[model samples]
Target: MSDTATVYRQRASARPRIEAEPPIRHVAVVGGGTAGWMTALLLAHSGYGPRLQVTVLESPQVGIIGVGEGSTSWLRGFFEELGIEESEWMPACHATYKSGIRFDGWSTRPGHESYFHAFASMLDNLTMTQFVDHVHRRLDGEDVHAHPDRYFLATRLAHACKAPRPRHEFPFDVWYGYHFDSVLLGAFLQRKAVERGIRHLPRHVVAVDRNERGDIASLQLEGGETLAADFFVDCTGFAGLLIDKTLQTPYVSYADALFNDAAVAMPTPLDGPIMSQTISTALRHGWAWTIPLTRRHGNGYVYSTAFCTPEQAETELRTQLGLLDADVPAKHLRMRTGRVEQHWHRNCLAVGLAQGFIEPLEATALMLVQRTASLFVDALEKGDLGAAAQATFNTAVNAQFDGTRDYIVAHYKTNTRTDTDYWRANAANTRLSEPLTRLLKTWLARRPIVGGIQQGTFGQGYPVMSWYSLLAGMGLFPDDGELRAPAAHEPPHSLAAIDNLIQRSALNFPDHRELLGAIPPRPREESLQVYFW
Candidate 1:
């Protein structure tokens, strides 16, 4: 043999064999809601061994805080991944397509000033920086009265109250989310998960037991049965049954940045045309989210208790919806704006409200749970994930939470509304993270661009275009005279092309109502009687 071959053979013979770590054969998820059920289903669908088992321990007495009624488009991919058909679930949950969110009366200008944060844009071919610069220049010149929504095809669809037909092959991508009944959604997911062989137990966890190594060993159910698993997932909402109360994870609060802590939600009978999007109308001391579903409307007033009372908020919501003097029952929700510093501990992981909560400003509750469970699934796929993987998961999840918190804070910090003490206090709040601070300073000097202040890879929560919309919507950008001049480089297409794109798509796409009518209607379950988050 050659010298190298002889050396390799000798070294291999001298080395000792190492054993692989044991795989996680069983996973026990505590709590049940959209988050717990989604995690269980995902794990069951991950193609683990037949011996691998997943069980969901849901309480029979706990109620669901049906506040996650709105969702981001990310859930669409999640559904597609799990082999779920839109046709079946949409009607089952009384769902509707959400093209985007429209913020009405958000600007300081007098009269009806509003803007849209659209999901789909026709400018997909252009870099985000290019789009931002073009819109900034246009706003400075002839389009001084322009809104960023003018550049998004989805905005046109939403405004026209139209939807793209599923059968038609479109050149551009169609982006959308859903507005659904959260409680109904949970029921649907629970049925699906149970059908797929995941054990669904309606039992409360009364006690938690841990191994000597500090990993979760088992859970004691209310009926005196002990359940053991190789790993545990905490989806116990604010209770944090496993990750927080048992593991003793540290937490970081966003209260200093995001002031809203209380919400009062009420549903109104469907009295008007169902819109194709979520409408967030700004209030004097808070904001009201109007989510239109096939059955009824989900409305809520999110405000800071520091500035407004719960009774005052409920009155404002009723008045805004023209239900003044109407004796309507309202549901109240209390929240703490914070997240655990570490989501994954020795052998336990927290998902959804158990991990953290930053309010529903961006409808991130469901999406965050999806992402957290997905990350844990990925770690499992890498054979054995020990301390290194735990550390990495915590770091990534923290960044996403903190990044989303900063984005929500920006809405308040950049607002020009000083009409109320709440607005004034929010605008003057001095607890901005350094990253957002740098970004806002840069935006003042010029327009925002992709990757400017966002954490994680592209396509994470709140992209650059979103920042531009919020800033321009609030009139926080520098004055036209001081704004940076457009880049000398020309755009690839003329403005007329964008207009043509919107016009052609609008003509081909069906009206939103027309599409909803086509979904072979199922008998609606008596509308869910519940309050909002």
Candidate 2:
């Protein structure tokens, strides 16, 4: 070679080479559903290339709890990262846009019985400071309208039955999620993962085998075949096959904090314009969720079996839906509300219902699954699944689950309803996590909640705006008689101005139904292959 060419070759040889093989060559995800498929897909997309093999061993006999589901904005990021288009999966899954949740009858306080918990948006930055200021003013006896619904653009869009998808000309981005058929979503994800070269085994996992280190060594199939991998993912729903049954991990229940334990779900015909919001109405026993899909409305009554029987819940739900005499069947689900002591144990990581479930009060099920799968991928890539890395991952995941529990528990604890024994019990019960207690203390003391959360080790699941919305929406404030006028120098916080801004901003989005209609149907060939998984 020439002198210049020889020098360039030497310099190139000195550079570090990328590792072609990942530390964990193969990962076996046991169970199939949204969690299983999602875990598989995320692993396949984790930049490990063909070196990291992913296998999903799903039981054909185990039916998925295909309830109507809503997700947080995390799911939008999930799809975007996977290069899946809204038009592609949304249409196939019978999905619709969700701006946020509309809570009704959770409180009996006048003018505060209903509130909207909106997903945070870029536009919130424009008004959050003023909103927080008004909240402080209202707490200090000023006659300010600090209701969160009036302050958020998502609430406005939801009220107007508008999609969160802003027009191309709209400068700011609006973050939102979706309501979809869970079964379809799982299938869609499975297809995507399979197309990306992930292996799928439609076989029953009859037994789990452990090595000398007590790590999951292999899974025994029904016909005596064995499937082994370097790592294992437990997506076995609430059964927690590997994490709970196999690993013998300890479970910490949240029964003292959250009372509702059972849910009865049934579908209702779409009766009106599709709304871009989930409706959570407090019922006699617990609460009812109304999730609107493109084809139907998914309605469920989540209550405590200790308070109401399955038949009673179904009857109440039927009464609510005006289907008391209708032949529509309701699917009842028993929920275990809590988390494992450790999410990542040994060579196994748990995802989905197997990880633990808080009541679906906030539609956080799928969001948690997404977080777990993504976090596990990052942990594995960074530390090659070492003990220290596992400990750190467990801490983060456990914190998230506990934090979510605290938030959901607050929903019940702060409820202003006393009509039912259940509601009364929730309000009277004092079993609260330290973080929630401190945060509540901060709010009641008229201190800055944001500061309290920032200062302490608060659960990092929900944002500060969410806490503000929940507490303020429930009218958890001092009595009006205790109020006094603002100081002369205090600048007025105009409710009309906020309203005007939100109203005008909402106009930038299209009607919810129209937006759903705009998404063209998936190709016939793809639709035909949807169930191939």
Candidate 3:
């Protein structure tokens, strides 16, 4: 791992620049939809639209390839940070608070399945000392599920349909996220960007022009008109018109790390607006996801081409869910699991599907668009807009992709189901990331540092409370060896402390049903509703 301090020094020395000077004056964003609009939004929101001309070249033909919305904690926070109002979002996107994902039937022998919810919150939490004591007590023949049941609050609240309250109202209650329609979220972002004075031209990119230095200098539209810019952002989706096609940057395939390449999405209706939560279940050929949006449920099967064909996969989906709407079409999208070696090459940076993508297990794909744009703006702030800064930016973007790739891979790798071809394929896959391999070894030794793909992804912005949920609730506990709290820690808090908070806080909140009743009829997910106890 590179030292943070050293990386900073090397970065500054690599790109010497004028202080507070904007290296990129006129920026051209290629493509549209969520990624393009997101990039434009951030640029405009950061006060770049006024000083640097920001033009989003969108093609009505190149529609966004997104199913419903399943996003991370960052997604909501990003909107909140941007000061976008709740009503501006909720009504348009079938937006609702998402505590976490519920995975059903990934374990057990053929056909039989059980499930657990991977919440942003946790069950009861005991300090290290208390946890060790509980473990010891368990070893001595006592059941500790009761203690952990109290410790992890999310488990009970999910069943009860209660949202976590502010810290003063509960014990260890903090951090939350959302589940909104992807298409609507994209529209919301586009509207905000335009409101901030961003220029959006609905034009399809026909060709990419490069200067002698191999940097993208202009974009040729379908009408034989050329648009020029000092810096270009390739939000062009998979075509990569500006980033790869013009710059000739090579892409590294992550198919080996992330096996599932294709997904079939179907929109199924429920009786009322859907509740907030995405259910990702492990299927035989691949994993299937059921997301309950406000008006309809978004269902998808993501599987590897090696295991099944599109036609076969579609058949399986239909058999599982019965026929989707006869009038509306069910779409099947194909993709490779990986990204460009350089997300930012030369003056061109590729965002969204163009940069790369893994399967959308946790909705990291959407956040990637926002994160990439925000990070580049950070780089720009560092006055490292020269060639060196660009290279470093590319390297850092790849790191983020690789990190996310491994994180998603962990979900499949840490599982122990091997009943069907799909499970077998995911299980037999021996390749794992270096960090994951180390974590797995630690977990095997019962030292439990952080194991599998999805372990410990939340950083300072995200705390231990979040990671601990997926760790314990999903049955991916670290081994007994690592269960001991770090040397100087105190005993964990009592489960009673956690549960009592929920019990008390539940009284103040409106019935989940009541809240839904007050809202307008949502656009989708008519059948499902979720409440926290």
Best by lDDT: 2
TM-score for each prediction? Answer: 0.87, 0.93, 0.81
The lDDT values for all models are 0.74, 0.83, 0.63
Clashing pairs in 2: none
lDDT of 3 by residue, 1-533 (tens): 11110110011011223346576788898877888887887776553326767999889786778787687756654664455555567668876656566767665422224444434332222232344355334333343431233444444444455443323333343234566678787787778888888888888877777789877788888888999999989887888877676777898888876788899988888664344456787777788888766677788898888888998888888777877335557798988777988887888888998899887887788778878998887777665587788777777777777767765776677566767776666767778777656655554454533223224332212223333333343455433443434333443345666567656654543333345444432222111112111
Candidate 2 residue-wise lDDT, 413-450, digit = tens:
88888888999999998999888888888788887777
Ranking by TM-score: 2, 1, 3
Residue-level lDDT of model 1, residues 269-304, one tens digit each, is: 875556778998889888999998888989999999
Instruction: Give me the displacement of residue 405 in model 3, in angstroms.
Output: 1.6
TM-score winner between candidates 1 and 2: 2
Ranking by lDDT: 2, 1, 3
Q: Which ten residues in a row have the lowest lDDT in candidate 1?
A: 4-13
TM-score leader: 2
Better of 1 and 2 by lDDT: 2
RMSD values for the candidates in order, in angstroms, are 9.7, 8.7, 7.7
> How many angstroms is residue 76 displaced in model 3 relative to the true structure, after the best TM-score fit?
1.4
